[model samples]
Target: MVMKTKLLLIAIILFSTSSFISNRPVTVFMIGDSTMANRSIQNKNNKERGWGMMLAGCLTDRVIVDNHAASGRSTKSFINEKRWERVLDRIQPGDYVFIQFGHNDEKEDPKLHTEPGTTFDDNLRKFVAETRSKGGIPVLFNSMVRRKFYCNENGLYTDSLIDTHGDYLLSPKRIAEEKGVVFIDMNKITHDLVKQMGPEKSKELFMWVGKRKDDTHLNIKGARIVASLAIEEVGKKIPALGKEIRRYDYVVATDGSGEFFTLEEALEMIPLKGKCTVLVRSGQYGPKPPFVNKKIKITEEKGVSWGSSAAHAEKPLKNLDLYLCVGQSNMAGRGKLSPEVMDTLRNVYLLNAEDKFEPAVNPLNRYSTIGKGLGWQQLGPAYGFAKEMATKKHPIGLIVNARGGSSIRSWVKNARQSGGYYNEAVRRTKEAMKYGTLKAIIWHQGEADCHHSEAYREKITQLMTDLRNDLGIPDLPVVVGQIAQWNWTRKPHIPEGTKPFNDMIKEIPAFLPHSACVSSEGLTPLKDETDPHFDAASQIILGRRYAKEVKKLIKK
Candidate 1:
């Protein structure tokens, strides 16, 4: 409800060295049923956030996420309410029209019901024609998959997924193809993800009340994940719009390893007399210059304030996908730095105790309990995972709070933490959320809990529950990294009863709702000796494994 709409102005525009300092903002206007609607958090729907609400987290200031979708509205009802007219009135060149529907349209009632090929197809054509009339691109997305899996007698899933919104899915695809608009298959992607998550875990990605499950609507985690899936598809189907989304930037760092050594080099390349705009950014690029230079003038930017740089604004990009990595030794990373990992830097970043979001380097679990959150162990799974998440064009932020020798008990709310690890984790999580939305938590700690294996499940579950409540994100998912294998390692290093402990870690999902486990099977530990920590390649692969599992918890 608060985001701005895009406007196409003449080319002559210039702002500070910001990404996409164009004539107008790129607007993405969404229209559909309650599944894609803008929800009010002030009432019963407080916990129910639609995918549109979280869409902003995936984009930079160059684009706008303007959601006009409403609940319980079918194609006929939307037209009658003048919702489509209001969206049409605001249409501009270079703007996008994202259309999705069907939940309310299947009703037997006349006002809500529309036969797929007849009324539904015709209505969809109206939207495409009108959008094209305004020189706007139109993209159609099918309905999302409901979290309905086939279950056994004990309430566990026996199969993958079940088809709930049947013919509705077919209608949108046929219409998009026939009308020559971009088509995004959200249902297929979400259906596969739901099946992979199974029955019990899939419910966490939807709205589940006291025995009343609204699989059609999503909670905050569900919304964010679904939004990511939609945008990813949008990027694929609409490549030009995808390029504007993010993943590339003109960064002029203080060290001068960037595209330009000085702003003068940047300005000299651009033609300032025309309507085209050039952005100039710097970390410590000396004295400021006049706004207008030979017909060039500066314009106020969205992400860039009057005089903010990368160090000051913390590399503002409107919003970022933030994850908190907290656990023990393996999470603290003990791998040797690999040369390949050094070259794997992109949109991934780490938030340190100093509150700066810098380009993420390995040994990410530095909480002062180990080392600085920079240049350690050569690489961690956080490196690969952060890179994976950022590849979608969203700025990814990681908050590190791992301790080397901490047990599951150390993560408890009132547990004994000599270094205040748990307390510091809570403090940092609360602080980091002020800068970015708390997406999920990546955890890896079980080697120390091996000795006290009896209390492992309860302590770990309590840790997750407490963290979510304290952070005010009741459904925040936890990605548990199953401890590395130590049975094959040299004699003295392998701890007693290691197999059972790892098996117990694998069963964590049965006791928890939104949590998922990533196996460390076949992962090679440190060679020449037998420590539980993973080696450079293993840690890198393990981070991607954790990332792959978390992708299921969040999206497909």
Candidate 2:
């Protein structure tokens, strides 16, 4: 069967944050007869394998395939042997159970015999209800074809395929229809496949070679094909689980030293609405590239020589400009949001708490991994700045990693340490860069560092150098905004070194390359002069000013 799926692969340095993009891992429990059991072959002469043996290879790492099927066990015997109870004991919420058991149920032996309309149907319903009771999703798959074909008068194998499972297959179908469970008709799918291959050629799928006369069990090659077929159906029936299925179509070398160089070039080869998976090899890959077709889903493959994470999106993202918004409270925005400022800006997205891009709205800094609580999250300048810069053709992505009441020393010192604000900011920015190009850095801090304003210029310069070097942008444009000019007459508690700090911020453009400073000369405070934070109106103006500086820098 032709499967339609979209997949992308990109190289990324391994980190704990890589797992944050996806939800918790889910287990897929496979329960059935020997046809689905895991077989042991001491010698290569036996050469018998089950389709379930290849299941895990068909899915992503998030899915764990636990095959519980046994040789010579039917639905009745499985429950009687407490095998079903064992499966039940391990079934957790959000797990999936694949139930397929009709092979041994067709036997006349009382130990496994079950009438299709009565005991078999009852057993199927019981499995579904009990799985749901444990909060596990239950999917029923009817028994596979037994390789029985009809022959014509000429002695050549006919195209007609016979059904050996008979009414037993109808039991799972009926139970699935009645209980509202997902059902995959493996009988019909295998029947069509076998019929198309004809009698002679189809033997390669089963164990019809020397010493192995088994027609029910599949060989290694056959197991892989069946596993792929089942996974394809799962993707179509269960979208959430299906999207996690892993497959590769291309290989990439990030260093531009291999056959395929960059991700953008690989993405350009995929046809529109077509599906492909690219395997990214190890190398140092920067973020200046844009995907030519669709937004890719990034999944991290660990333990390999080259570590990587993948990202995916349905819509096409082109020329996505990314900016790192950092510093203290002003950059995080203490402004009260108005209705207009709260509205989501068109073509602007935020690298949210989950590291996925969502529409840019108020409290853009709420997604900061190192930032404070949601109460501190409010209207930030990024909303207005993105609004001023974003267009229908060119989208924008913002990484607002700032904290309130933070000192310049804290930022500079933390730049070299792990789990600190500076490193957290860099990590988040790099994650966001996987989807877009880094445009500039916006800094509006220094309030808490007023006590050390005498050397503010020197410290801020060091901070800029560290940020640019670590981010792989040696001459990246840096835009600093002057701290709020507290009304001293009404707010006498304002820091004595506030004027000096502002002077140092204003002097950034003099010596720093590709850098500028935005003026906060007339911006309004949050509530009154006593409030050090900017008001909603002033935050909007600050955003516009920052965008103006960015536009001028981009021109050069």
TM-score of 1: 0.43
Residue-wise C-alpha lDDT for candidate 2, range 1-556, written one tens digit per residue? 1121111001111111133243656667888987787765334344566787667657765665667888899999999998898578556567789999999999999999999999999999989999988767888999999888887898776788877888998988788767667789999888888888888888998988786677788876677677778888866776767777766544444222122455666566655566556555433233535554444543323311221223223443434799999988878877754334545567787787667676665678867776754435667787678889999777888999898767777788564433388887788888888778899999988777764666787888888899899999998999999887764324356545367667777888997889999999898876566556787788889999999999999889
Error of 1 at 48 (Å): 54
**lDDT for each candidate structure:** 0.67, 0.73
User: Per-residue lDDT tens digits of candidate 1, residues 1-556?
Assistant: 1111111111101111122334445567888988887665325335676787666556654566667788898888898888898577555566778898887788888888887878987888888889878767777888888877777789876756678777888988887656655688989888887777777787888888677788788876677667777777777655555665432223222222223334555566655556443333312343454445645543322222123236534544336678988877677776654324444256665675466565554446643333322222235678777767785457777887776667777678887654676777878777667667888999988877775555888888888998899889989989998776666433375455477778888898888889899898888865432457777778878989888888899972
Candidate 2 TM-score over all chains jointly:
0.44
lDDT score of residue 19 within candidate 2: 31
For each candidate in turn, the TM-score is 0.43, 0.44
Error of 1 at 556 (Å): 8.5
Clashing pairs in 2: 295-313, 296-311, 296-312, 297-310, 297-311, 297-312, 298-310, 298-311, 298-312, 299-310
lDDT of model 2, residue 91: 63
Off by over 4 Å in 2: 1-22, 44-46, 248-301, 304-556
RMSD of model 2 against the true structure: 19.3
Model 2 per-residue lDDT at 31: 89
Candidate 1 C-alpha error for residue 461, in Å: 0.6
